[model samples]
Target: MLKIDDLIIDKEFEELLPVLTPEEFVRLEQSILKDGMLDPIKVWEEPGTGRNIIIDGHNRYRILKKNNISLNYWENYKFMYADELPTRDDVKRWMLEQQLGRRNLSEAEKYEMVQKFKSVFEQKAKKNQSLGGKGSTNLPKVDTRKEMAKATGVSEGTYRKMDVVMKSDNEDLKQKLREKKVSVDAAYKEVKSTDQKPITVKQQIDRLDKRINDIDKTIESLQVEKEEIIQRRTSIFYALDIKCPVKYRWDKKGYSNTFPCFWKCQIYIENEEYENIFGEYSVYYNEFPSDCDMEKIPETYRNDFRMIWKKAHDEIKALQDEVDKKSMENAKKQDEILKNAMKLIPTDEDKVILKQFYRVLANTYHPDNKKTGNAEMMKHLNDLKAVWGI
Candidate 1:
């Protein structure tokens, strides 16, 4: 006696039910909340026992039970007979095919299910095929109720709602329902609306992607502006008195006892109310134009020698700031230059090696005393400082 809403599951059926883990159960619960059931449970009469037998959806039934849903809600639920439903082997095969299409299934689980379904179907199919070709063909085929439900493809449990709409007497509505299945609610509303059109899934996906692209562009623009601001702030160091004195190595051996400059002979003459103290010095080895000793200093500048030294120190410090700032800017600009050059340059490895060579040269000339092995090896260090940037 195959029937629809009349059969009920019994306690014995619970023992034979397939297991579901907590995570799976939660997902099902949420899906039910969002989209509802797409496929109705496949139920058949338990031969002579007179109870509703669940051919599929045991998980859904259990979930409904756990949540204490009223059984009355399922009163009008449409059911199919065993003759209308697919056989066990068919159901298993369909399950395997579904698992294969899904990315989330584990390899072991997929393999075991696939084997289980295929072996059973092959064995039965072979046995049936052995008998008279017609009889073998007539041998009970497996159940594909799940697959049929899937092919119908309503949002989830909405198939039940779809069944109601599909079974309506209006010919136009029925034709629309027969058309490739879309959202049940949407199909229903279309007939009710002045306009009878439905939206497609591709349109939905495209809309989502467009939104994501727009957000990415916005973030990129903001980031570029942020970097620009940081660069501008860094440029201020060029005008600031920020030089921290650094020592460097001039030679591998060490400094000579002599200062790298010449000396002067001084004369002091005094005659009532008039006095003069002056000296003349000679120039010594220098990389810069004005690096001479007191011999070249003019007599008009004799009184203010302290002031001259102070101003010279200030000027040197300012130039040092300019060199440091320019170096930082040049490096930033050169990184992009190097990256572009690498694309055209034939020998990438050689370029990398060359860069390393230059880095070593820079380090050798670095104006940090501790970076060198010994202070004595730094005698002419100050000479190099004048043209440090070059």
Candidate 2:
């Protein structure tokens, strides 16, 4: 007398069944429509709740409901009860066993089902132990891997590889195994080969030192280039015989701030006679106002001054920014090197070897030896020695 609406769907039990493909579902529905309900829906009565939960025939149940076939009207409609399963864990174990027993399951599916079975068995064993009841004696002590491998029809070694693939983070490899595109041995080898080995402390320190040295060289080169640019800009001003402004400042409250009393240069305009069109104006280095009248000055000299002024200022600013960035990077590298060096705890023998190593480096990089000497390298060697308390 069970109605279609009375059957409860348990998500945990439903997930144990593999999802049907679209084509398979359509074919199943067509078969059911051609015939009547040929098979019964298997359900379990939840002990206290007394609700009938569908444990099998989910696809057939869907087809019956879609066609609106009432159990009362159809004489062949039937329901089979799974009366043996008394607990939820027992139901889960039964569902997993049923899925594992199917002949059409892929190796990946079999492996996954076996893993679930193992988990359920362990949980049941633990529960029995905790309860300390007489039922605990009936539970056999089983070697999980050997028993599962035998049930799965695979060797123990292949079972172990399948376990690795299931536990790995590589989703694509798992899918390939499921689709039978790759064997278990090949997937396991790929995972092992791509794993990175741990880096040692000495190797880490050497890498940091190299990075710091490269940053220092970059900063030194940028400084030299900046100095050359400044010299070039100063030469242009001197060659033009133009007295530029000494300093410039912006005032927030008005022009209350006193402007430096600097000398000015005048521009002569050619128009039948040389006339001083731009009487006198101060030329601030980089703060020259954009709205200034430039038409009064001769075209050639005006263009040359504007070009060099902008070029020098822009290049110097860019160089300073780069130097600042390099300096920050060097600081971080130095900190990392110190941290990695501190991890080393030299033994008595190690200390003796370290002393001899330090002497060789100090002599090679001493500032007094001009050919191979590096003051920066010598400083780093001393810093490391102090950190180690050697």
Candidate 3:
């Protein structure tokens, strides 16, 4: 007597199931249309709510609804309820096991299911400990790696390599692993090779230099944007024929504390036309005694002024904060570059000899000397000195 509408689709439970491919879905739909629901829909009757939540046979349920077929029409249609699963975690474990048992899953999908199973096992273990219970379920012990390997039908070492492959940033490698186009060993080796490549000192300096340049450019851009906002705010104040508030000025000192008072001042009131706008609200000098009711202002001016006011203050503060952060980052990068460059210098004991050698080289290759001058050698010597941070 249960109707299709009576069954609930829990999103959390549904997400645990794999999505069917278009071709697979089409085949399933066609089969149901012809065969008329052979497999039973397994559901869980949630206590208190009394709702039959679909835990299995989601695809069959979807097909049936799409074709407007009623569950009552088929005499063989069955409903298998999961009455023993008293908790959500129990249901999740069951779902994961069902997914692991299916033979259609790709390697990537199987690996992902094992990971989910491991996570659920850990969570259940923690819950049991908190409740002073021991060995409640047959879930694996602390050594999840062994369990994961067994579930995936691979050795522990191979499972470890598979873990590395899954966690790597290479999307193509991951896709290949999923499709069985690449082995876990190959993908893991590639990732390790890429990560193990050492960065030379020169490369490190170049990277730091590039980062400093990028931060400088970002600060410049933010400054330009801040200037534009200030210009717009100035124009609005000018159009209103009122002197711009000192707090609103971009160059004003202690402006952050004073800016909030601008909305309440009699300056916005202008002449008698808007005098009573403040009404019972008292306006004080240089600061508002109470909250400013912005709704009293004329719609045309209020919107524009409020927008520009907020934009001007917020943009300026945000720009300053970003610029300060970038400046600090730039300083750190410059310091790092200096530290790397200093590493090229000789030890203290060799400093005197090294300086003497450098002096002789500089004199011999002096670009300013008419007879001894060798411009190329002088340039090379200077470049060496710069690299050593001398």
Every candidate's lDDT:
0.46, 0.65, 0.65
Which is the leading candidate under TM-score?
A: 3
Runs in model 2 with CA error above 4 Å?
A: 72-83, 116-119, 131-139, 142-151, 197-390
- In lDDT terms, how accurate is model 3? 0.65
Model 3 Cα lDDT, one tens digit per residue, 226-300: 654554444344357553321223333334533433322222333334321122222222122222556544444
Q: 7-125, model 1: which lDDT tens digit per residue?
A: 46543233223357889789988886577666566565433234466645667666666665534334413454446434433434444454456435332233223333433445454
lDDT of 2 by residue, 1-390 (tens): 778898788755675577899999999889878976676667778654476888877888888888997665234344434468866667767777677775577788788766645655666555666565655576565566777776677998999988887766567999999889999999999877644555578756775876686576556544643653554444344345443422212222332212222323233332333222333444333434244555533454575445544544454445456666777899999999998887776777887888999999998999988898999999999998986568
Clashing residue pairs in candidate 2 (N, C-alpha, C atoms within 3 angstroms): none
In model 3, which range of ten residues has the least summed lDDT?
282-291
Local error of candidate 1 at residue 260 (angstroms): 99
TM-score of each: 0.26, 0.44, 0.46
